[model samples]
Target chain A: MRGGTAVSIAYQTLRLSDLPGLRAAIRSGDYVKHTAGLGAGHLQTNLAILPEAYALDFMRYCQRNPKPCPLVGVSDTGDPMMRTLGRDIDIRTDVPAYNIYLDGKLADSVTDITDIWRDDMVAFALGCSFTFERALEEAGVPQWHIDHDTTVPMFRSNIETVPAGPFGGKMVVSMRMIAPERIDEVREISRRFPLAHGAPVHIGDPEGLGIADLSRPDWGDPAEIEPGKTPVFWACGVTPQVAIERAGVPLCITHKPGHMLVTDISETAEVPVLNPKHH
Target chain B: MRGGTAVSIAYQTLRLSDLPGLRAAIRSGDYVKHTAGLGAGHLQTNLAILPEAYALDFMRYCQRNPKPCPLVGVSDTGDPMMRTLGRDIDIRTDVPAYNIYLDGKLADSVTDITDIWRDDMVAFALGCSFTFERALEEAGVPQWHIDHDTTVPMFRSNIETVPAGPFGGKMVVSMRMIAPERIDEVREISRRFPLAHGAPVHIGDPEGLGIADLSRPDWGDPAEIEPGKTPVFWACGVTPQVAIERAGVPLCITHKPGHMLVTDISETAEVPVLNPKHH
Candidate 1:
């Protein structure tokens, strides 16, 4: 809200404390726009819902490749209620947008999936890069995409994700232009949020990850690398989406890019440290 | 060898560097005993093998309850090899002892499982308490069970585990007597090994976890608490065993209580810090 150019769609000037109200609006179909600054300071997530047949493999896929798919919450089979993520959070209609895929191809994008929700389906919410992006911004790091009103540039890389079942493909990475001097500071800050794709996978050369052309990204608009700025890459949530496509599951549902599931968990909630002495 | 009374069975003096040789000796049936001090500085694991029918649920079960079941390695379905754990490791023959369970009942204890190895079976190696115990010992913490040449006392606690499919039961914990003054130091040291059950789940009162008597443990011999000592409880690997029992799977195989699967991974190996700066 402070730095980025606002989108054309009208959104209420909401504060971090107004998350429940915002979510209610999203559920009522009153707000179908991308959720960026609406629920500021709260954790927003990427959504992936699959059938029971594919649930185990996809869960394993996430476990093996945590950098790309840091699982924040998983719903029980056939249960639309994601109690672990938030109160009254129904997977069938919580998100603003959902992309339904059939046989590895996108069939339709819908605002509500209550009609198509299946008893054999399971929903998984993954930590989105937005969590760390917010952290970086709060720490005074500049984000070029937010400065201009554009999506962050993302590209496919040569790094192959650890395969699980039918899910295996080259990792997808989101690129950000940062001054070389701030690399270490950014790394340290980002490393603390393991659920939000912890740290940058590649800091310097895009070519090192087999990325030939920076201007031509696989997804999102390309951002120019200003002089003295280095292109830093982080494992993207899209990596799992691509893997899901490759797996060719009969039916899959995901959040439309930029449309996320906002949760009650605060972005600054202390990552659960295992301490027996206190318990 | 230094603190505990030695077992009567003669074991050739083996050093940290003698892991491969010791594992080979164990595989050849030359050694069949507790693996606490053997292969020092290396990771030792508790094994759990289940049929594919229950594999997904069990994996999910472990994921939900990480403290009791810190998964270190999971083999592909029908595969006898654990490629990630160690070189030339065969799940069928590597371990010195295996407990075969039939429908929640102990069926038999065997030296080798090659005869019962099934194409539908999946092998999982969970991080054992031994890894952090080694860390504690290295940090000058005294383990009374090890000092007395007895197994650490284990008890079933009243705390229920987060259920996954058919796997849900009260958590199992192993008790250790520590000086009240050294509790903080021990907690700090053990917390570093997340893969090794990390820190204690409970610190002082045994009855807080519904444990009535410290001297009357459900399993393993009990150690007398010395003056100025407090009981510390860690989530035990035996947790999964109890859950599996409650699950009542048709066929499940696990490692014999103390006999573990020794891996090539060093106990002090940096627990895979996800640093994208290098890659």
Candidate 2:
């Protein structure tokens, strides 16, 4: 039980009580690793930390293009604690890994962003496909990537996102191979989770979204498309990261691909990231 | 045209092409009046401006209590131009009127905020009930407001809004008298405009939402519950103003009641205020 088997046991038996300790361990120098299946049933999010100057436009970008960037939590300017997401979650160090970008370029990767944290910085937590992936598995929808032990294939599309100030770029989509019979099930299940890239954007023909070949993806490993199966594409969270890169902002930070911040919010509940009910 | 009645004609016959001129007229001090039917069929929005320090919380406040504050536009911090709603519209002067609040108290009313504008201020445009009121009229649901030419009846409800940061207060509701047969028709019509305080929150029984009597209201005019008519209550845009008053923020600004910023967006065809199709 050294590799995949160990991961299975660690994830299958994971409980809510074990999350705090696990997150604390990650925050320290102990468990710096990918958070793929660590806390099942809890929501995991893609992180983007940017200067206050870019916050409003980025928010507008999200508001205008919610499918790719369904905002889940927004931290106060200069504040790191995402009080709405979890208790005592220090964004600067809680994530398993951080990807540092300088002038819209990937400059370095690190386990913590404590030294880089600034008072003018604001953080955004966006819903990731992981939430819906979990749902797909529960609903008995077969995913070729998980079956073949590869990452979900993603492609850059020609679809231009509604521009907001300096943030504008083509939408990026992730592809999954599903059987013909299970397509409706996937659609039904995904629509219920709007926070998670809800529903498939396209059902078939990779060329429809400008994908030349499913085997050659711009990002992530390509999965097999079995006979009688159709490829489903969903709006990917990476679209913003790409836009951020193209904008050439002076400084930005995001969660490293596959390394996410697991939140205490239950994946099954319709929890509001902003909690506007009492206002 | 002596009072609002005489002025109503100037707006009722006004065409969409005149919006830019109307906004310009307001900006140049030539017009200091309420914006009602000036841009007929176009959307009019309630405005709220806050400093960056309180923006994230207030954004959450609006997100949580969307019915009252169905966010139509949010300006980037320090930028007064509302890029999404209108290209030429400037937040500083486009609105016909503004009420300034200091420490939760009314400070002054102004026609333009240009003199007091700050680089860190953020502007928010919330959907006004005017759009849905128009829809109800089109659906043949007679509104006491349009018939009597009075402000719709508004009440402070027993329902407490979900609190976010320092913003939390009782929910406010606007009531309209609808014929019994038109209740569902009104609901169907209003439901189409989520940004316009979508549908009725309460259909009847004023006591259910903590109202003592129909004749008395926390804000706006009293109502006459005509025979075979039921009082339909919708979430009022006044909720945020109530919350702002309770929060006691150092400063806040809201559209003077009934005055709004009319936009190029049409009342019927504009995408759902928070619709994913456009976002």
Candidate 3:
């Protein structure tokens, strides 16, 4: 299984443009691994599934804190199909892995959730930072964490998200070290992808976000701040997980940390500008 | 009363920056008039109130159809205080007038909704075109409707808004005639206010939107399309009103056509960018 996972990861990296094929591999359980660089030009989303009772308040929380939770697609109540996101994506089995939470505590991880599917479940697909990370890589901006083949370091920041019902907690952010010269270019490029956590929440001074040490992080790997490099922070998708823990709902489901749901929508697809003439 | 209303309208035109004083006048029934140019640099919003049972669906509708319904602020259930919009905005009495809709039919127009405020009701304040209109006026583009002291002509368009649940209908657009050369500048200026209906949905042909005659509009008085001036259309705030009517909810409340809720936020107030460094 380990060798099979490694081979599948290599294959996925080579066929970055084949979204449907990649999704198929993920759905079939043949490629059960992180989807960091799988769908290069396509949008990858963080998943959150909650019962209909908690759906409204959670939606409000996303609305209030859009930077951390840019919602790309939402499924109808009790519906497993995400029609707006892809041609035939099933929420229950599309992702490589899903983390099942019982009363906000991790109960188990599973490849398929069909057994736990409920009549009142609502799935939310949120934009992930990988979309903008690809954009940055395309524009020649180097990412230290990616180069080192390690997960991006994430930290819980001092900044508090606007409270909506039980979904309120300090925001979580991911750090990337970049040369000072490329900071402006990176900011400009990222701002275009507002749906994917556009722009840096902080460019320098980790202490500003209440982080005492650059070497210590709440999640993922520790990044080295090389000479002439500055630390840049962006709102992380893990934020919803933090909120979910605080909410302590009876049952909640989410994609594993780095494992994501790949959608058919292009990362560069201009946020739908409704032009009557074109229609 | 007619003379007093006229005097208050003129008074409001002069005291554009005084939002609180203006709201006081509106609350007192001293200014029962259109709020086109009332709050010059401040943001004016279109109001919609719905029962909690229908709130989630209505919010989903707005999320799916953001062009016509860019939500600026949402109130907690049964809470009339719009804390985010202004210092002391009471949803019940801040607007100059309210339109009561009972089962999709116009029941009556009232000056205050204090008597009808429900514990299960939720209020939503949506971005109005007035914010971008002020930007256009500031940028030296003449709005013929405002110049003539008349309402902007609104029409029902062929463009169907992306629906959610029971809320589904064709979009409503407000038309403004612009000189051919200034069309580019107007588009650029208006694009800055994405929250305020963003850019024109149609630039030249009224027939494209299914409007056969410019002189006959579904709502508001007609404006003459001056020679060499092309007709430009923008998504109107009234699109939600049409959806509310189509949904046929038992009871709904909205600001009477041109009567809006004046908020204290500046028109140019940069959309809150979550920067941890700044905090």
Candidate 4:
């Protein structure tokens, strides 16, 4: 909404507070831009849709490694509606846009996946760092990426996720520059949002997590590190995308990067790891 | 070890602090008694092992309904070793006794399940009430059944669990008589250990949970209600067993009632819903 090009369809001007209106817009192919700054207080999820065959192991991968893939909700096998996440939330057309992954590689990007929706597929909703970033802003500790107007820088770390089926790989982490004095406050507030990757897995040293450079992140745009601040990392939702890509399932679908599915759930609602800590 | 005869065999005087010795005693059929006070501060677990065919649904069932099925650990799809739970913990011989369920009914009870263990089976260790009951005792709220020297009273509640695949049913609750003034403290402490069926689902009236009479529990022995004390119910680990029984999986294995698999995990180590809130 802030920087991306918004291609509005046949609809009135959409307000940020209107959840149903926003979803309806997304469903109707009205707003296909990134879901940043929209539905400000509500939960925004990183989406993953896969065949039922891979769901069990994939879920095991999630349960074993929660910080990266804090599963918020899982749709019933072959079911399009995610009754658990919110009201009338259809997984197929609810997101702003979809990324079609064929054998774990990006094949096509589309507005809606209604044409490719299959009976054997299951959808997973994971907690996004945006929830905690909002919490941070409310708490008066603004994040680096938001201030710089860039995507949260992500990297593949030396930390290996607990393997389950074919979906195990190095954990992908998002970097944030935290002032030395405010690190504890950030950790305490973040601890309250485990669904939002909880507290940082690694703080201070990037080499401890085996990343060679801070400016060259594996994914997302790299940001500057202020003189007194240290780089902090949280397990990223993109970790699962990395794993999914490595797993190479015949058919997998996800929200195009930055494009997310916003839900009716409030940010303070615990997303309920109270899991999106093992859902 | 106290009331139920601990048939101590060839092993020389086993100390309660020794985990491997205890497991060895159980594995060798030396100590085949109910594991109530055996491990003391160490973690005890309720178990369910199903072929990989049903593992995903069962795990999802655990994820959806965490209180009743607080998943402490899950083994790899075909692995007998619960490396995630503890060091060198083998599911086949660790539990004191195993209850084999076939087509939703009790088929056999055995001291060892090595012969029936399948290559495709997955074992799930759930936090037993003993973990929280130990916590409660430390908090100075002695439970009625423990004080009275009887099994915890259990009943089927009208509250249905969140269904996942073939594993949905009414929640089974275990009741403990708490003094009216201490309910809040009990609830807080219970919340801290979400792994051990955190917090009570119902309090005071038995009818609220569709429990007909406190004197007649559906499972386990009924303990007398202390006058002026309130009846509080916690979601029981037995809930999953009920679901498993109803689901009628071709091959299912669980710990015999009262007999549990004791692990090396400490009671205070969080089990770690920080899960047993979502995991």
| Candidates in order: C-alpha RMSD to true structure | 3.8, 6.0, 3.9, 4.1
Candidate DockQ values, in order, are: 0.27, 0.15, 0.29, 0.26
Model 4 clashes, total count: 5
- Which candidate leads the pack in lDDT? 3
Tens-place lDDT digits, model 1, residues A113-232: 999999999999999998888889888999988777678999999897877789999999999999988999998888767678878988888899999999999999878878889999
Q: Compute the lDDT of residue B47 as modeled in candidate 4.
A: 94
Estimate candidate 4's alpha-carbon lDDT, on a 0 to 1 scale. 0.81
Clashes of each: 2, 10, 0, 5
Q: Which stretch of 10 consecutive residues in model 4 chain A shows the poorest summed lDDT?
A: A270-279
Q: TM-score, chain B only, every model?
A: 0.93, 0.92, 0.92, 0.92
Candidate 4: which pairs clash? Answer: A70-A276, A71-A276, B272-B275, B273-B276, B273-B277
Per-residue CA lDDT of model 3 for A138-183, tens digit only, reads: 8888887887778899999998887778898999999999899999
Interface RMSD, Å, model 2: 5.2
C-alpha lDDT (0 to 100) for residue B29 of candidate 3: 76
State, as a TM-score between 0 and 1, how close model 3 is to the true structure: 0.89
lDDT winner between candidates 2 and 4 = 4
> How does model 4 score on DockQ?
0.26
Query: What digit string (tens of lDDT, one per residue) describes model 4 on residues B1-279?
Result: 234243344234754347777888887877766888777578888999998888878887887777888877788878898866677788999888999999989999999999999889999989889878887888888777777668999998887887887998999999998898999999878866767887777778888878888899999998888898999989899999999988989889999998998887787763232212122
What level of docking quality does candidate 3 show? acceptable
